[model samples]
Target: MSQSTHLPRTSLAALTLGAIGVVYGDIGTSPLYAFREALAQSAADGISRGEILGVLSLALWALILVVTLKYVLFLSRMDNNGEGGVLSLMALASRATGARWLLVLIFGATGAALFYGDAIITPALSVLSAVEGMRTIPGLEGMGEHTILITTTLVLVGLFALQPRGTASVAGLFGPVCLVWFAALAGLGLWHISRDPGVLAAFNPAWCLDFMESHGVTGLFVLGAVFLTVTGAEALIADMGHFGRQPIQLGWLVLVWPALTLNYLGQGALALHHLAVSEAHHQLMGNEDWFFLMAPDALRAPLVVLATLATIIASQAVITGAFSLSHQAIALGLLPRMTIRQTSAAQVGQIYMPAVNWGVLAGVIALVFGFRSSSSMAAAYGIAVTGTMVVTTCLSFIIAWKYWKWEPVWAALLIAPFLCLDLFFFGANILRVTEGGWVPLLVAAMVGTVIYTWLRGRRVSLERAREQGVAMADLAAALAVRPPVIVEGTAVFLTQDPEVAPSALLHNLKHNKALHRCSILLKVETVNTPWVDPAERVKLEVLDERFTRVRLRYGYMDKVDLPSDLARHPGPQGGGLLSAKGGTSFFVGRSAIRFARKPLLPRWMTVLYMFLHRNAADPTAYFAIPPNRVVELGSQIEL
Candidate 1:
């Protein structure tokens, strides 16, 4: 179902390699800290052989059911015109059910907002964990927490600063280098496993059940840590548009899955081997830094370097994902338009959002300084990831039943097992609220509230504005008989409603007492799909030869260049009325909004909406209009 599935074999292989570098970066780095955290979490249960084996089993099955099956196989197919993300999925599902499903809209928006919290935490936690590997080095035992903290803060700052420059030059290396990282994971696990093959029995589900039975209620707490192994699953789905479907699936099944599985198994084996040989197994029970501890002293420093690089790569993936999500939000009208800068001429997906970049930077820095270490920050990570997965499951069920046209019973039956697994992960993470998990939840709640309020307030504002507008036909007929002083040059008025006269046009007529020979009203429309055909993009209607109305339709992913698109059609009635050589001015109306005496939106929302509106990007920049040839008309609206 990937758009590029029909590509030549060689090209497909190349994309598969590229997909490994970007898509797998987050989940791939998990072996560095995920296994250690899971081991440490088992301390609540009192360490035993059964508990170790059970934890490993739970991690393996999570990868199988959640990532491999749910995301790679099921959700990947739910693309919106070869694009995939929470917003795209929401658009697809909502189209099938129409305006009746309010639940779908709320869940879709919440899932998107939750992603912002994860974006902030990922860079801080990942860099801190990798830099903490300095603790495992010889003679650096006294280097302490302050040293790691400073080092991580510096790296994160530099990474964010470089975002404006784009990633195309060095992006090619991400693939070849990650290949080595996975190979190292696989090789390390194989070495330790050769020492004691008995730990390999964790591949069996029976071991997971045995460990659960041994630990009882405490074992459920381990699910929170075990959940980290698959956090990258959501990132992979969001990045599906960059590399397409088949490439991601091939990379995961072939390289990523086996490497991660082997590394986790290797850590388990090393822990068991240490527990059996040392008499002080109690001190070493849950303190299995066995991931780095498995290697020789000579290789430890090099592994740290490799890990630091990988985590940086992982951090990059999430930051880029944040940019993409923010762009989608602007297109869907969940937020006011922000400045979107295209960083690459060759690749359209390489974009940079200034607000998103700095906002995430602020959050990450606060998290690093506040949490102090990766172990502490790790408590905040899994809840957001699990919460998103649960939301995805519910949304996907709607897609299956409504869009894909499956029987309701069959769809629910198929998705029920995955939903149950997601709920268990969410519940396990609920226990972490006291242990610093409240950070992401609080951030998500604040963000989600703002987005919902902005959307609702905008809707009510539009309804009130529309009621004051006069129909274009009536205005056109009135002007034909009364005819204002006709001038020589051309004038263009931009409006939201094509059926009604633009406020800018009305204001110009009232003040100037003159009209251009060619007066055109142009309205921009955003389509529900990803890309609109250029042939069907611009529609021109005739209202007498001198006055015309043109409609430009664009998909959410499409960019509008009013100057360029109009260049193709010269004269009146789809012909170029506006000249490339002469005096032509674009008239835009700027609204000065005032809250109504009895507001439709909540009082708090009205304040936030006004603030966002004042700070949003200027229309002159967003529509790519030539600033030199623009005129502004001001109007006051009460909503």
Candidate 2:
């Protein structure tokens, strides 16, 4: 399972298609509401031709600078081995900076937490916007209008429920479906682009600068809406572990970016043409209800369905990413262990976490019912995505200077403009904190607290372990003098630290008064890098040729399978496989952690840690050990 970092042999086309399906989902759906929201935000000035052109110019530049240059061309190259994402990127940067830059580490973790906040909002906003196209359709206008929420909820229910079954088979459909979606966007945009070619002039930076000069501070605030254009850019980095770098870049540059630009420009052209027709109707026309106006009347219903599918796919991307991130968090010891299900044998990236699935579903349902409209949810969306984007850019600067060996001045020069853009959007979004922007910020704060607390709690647990536990060397020496009765079968004792005697091992010897003929003291370690080579994964030291101290090193991105990994090694003195079906037994050490009377941590933190520990997934299931052959021994530990 530690070998999960190894890219499975895949064709170029297959990888490209897969990347388009997953990596582009979020950005692909942005055209539905991002432009609409930006227009709505700036409609106070009556949606003039200059404002339409300026907004489109800002959006086009955002795609080029932020998603195109910043993410695809730059950050994609900064992957930790083949893995990318907030946490994995943090792991890589931390290794380069060592542990001294604690602030950078916290920023990285906070970015990951903020992503979950965005994750919760995407489905509700996307589906709501897509389904609201119902109001645009000719006969369907206000007919069964209340059913929109019920329909969106049902669709969400189906999406989350399908997680346990995996996405491999249907994943093929995703590529084709998205291919059609992007094509529709391009075709639709082209239809309008040809009508009013003057909107094509929005590509000129002069229009952007002129618009900014005229609208100063309010223009800066409108960037919060413009920031939505590149929200899915981070996904291109985060999902790198799933489809690798080339395919993602290939999909983005060749198809996704161009299609999105055309669609946005086309929307602008359509709006400008409408404004040209009558300035008095501009304010009424420039609204969240206007995106569907880009499409012709007859195609509106079909486009609605396509948009809904695209949004669902977009939600899938975020949900799948959350699962992957949560899995990585547990592997790296930032979170309590949660059950991870390998949903597909063919693709290692296709995994499901039920707890995450349900938690996200609950949040999505709440957001849908609470906000009730995409127009309202838009206020809550930009803050978390922009905040995470800001942190990622900051972290990338460190990676460039420290890891990539870029010169200090050169690194700062490269990242400075992008950082400024990020900060501007972040600051703009902050102004809306009272107007629903606080939702994601609140979610981010709570999640960040949990991540930091869990990390701190683990440190305390390890310190307590090192202090009270006996050394394996001393135990082996004592055993050499007076050995316990040796039984027939092999026993693999899972320990927190291989150097210290495991509580389960101590319990087994104390109560049973016997030891297996071949005993292995095993500890699985999470390293700073993204992968540990399988050949170098296991470290075995024979303690008197009968008791072996085994340490298995894995990266935060690695999949852990105790039974499968142990099967590849010998029991003692290279005799035979360590686990032999029913002949083997796996011993796990668990602690009933409680708050100490005089606590090193705050009482709130201690209680939180204890609650997480109590609800964490069992070691046997998480490590992929056969439950039938496992024994768990619990000992009380007051934190």
Error of 1 at 4 (Å): 3.7
The superposed Cα distance between candidate 2 and the true structure at residue 519, in angstroms, equals 2.6
Question: In candidate 2, what are the lDDT values of residues 435-487, reduced to their tens digit?
Answer: 78999988889889999889898889878877888998999889878989888
Model 2: CA > 4 A from native: 1-10, 98-100, 143-145, 280-288, 577-582
lDDT of each: 0.85, 0.85
Top TM-score model: 1
lDDT of 2 at 188: 86
Which pairs clash in model 2?
none
Off by over 4 Å in 1: 44-46, 279-284, 569-574, 577-583
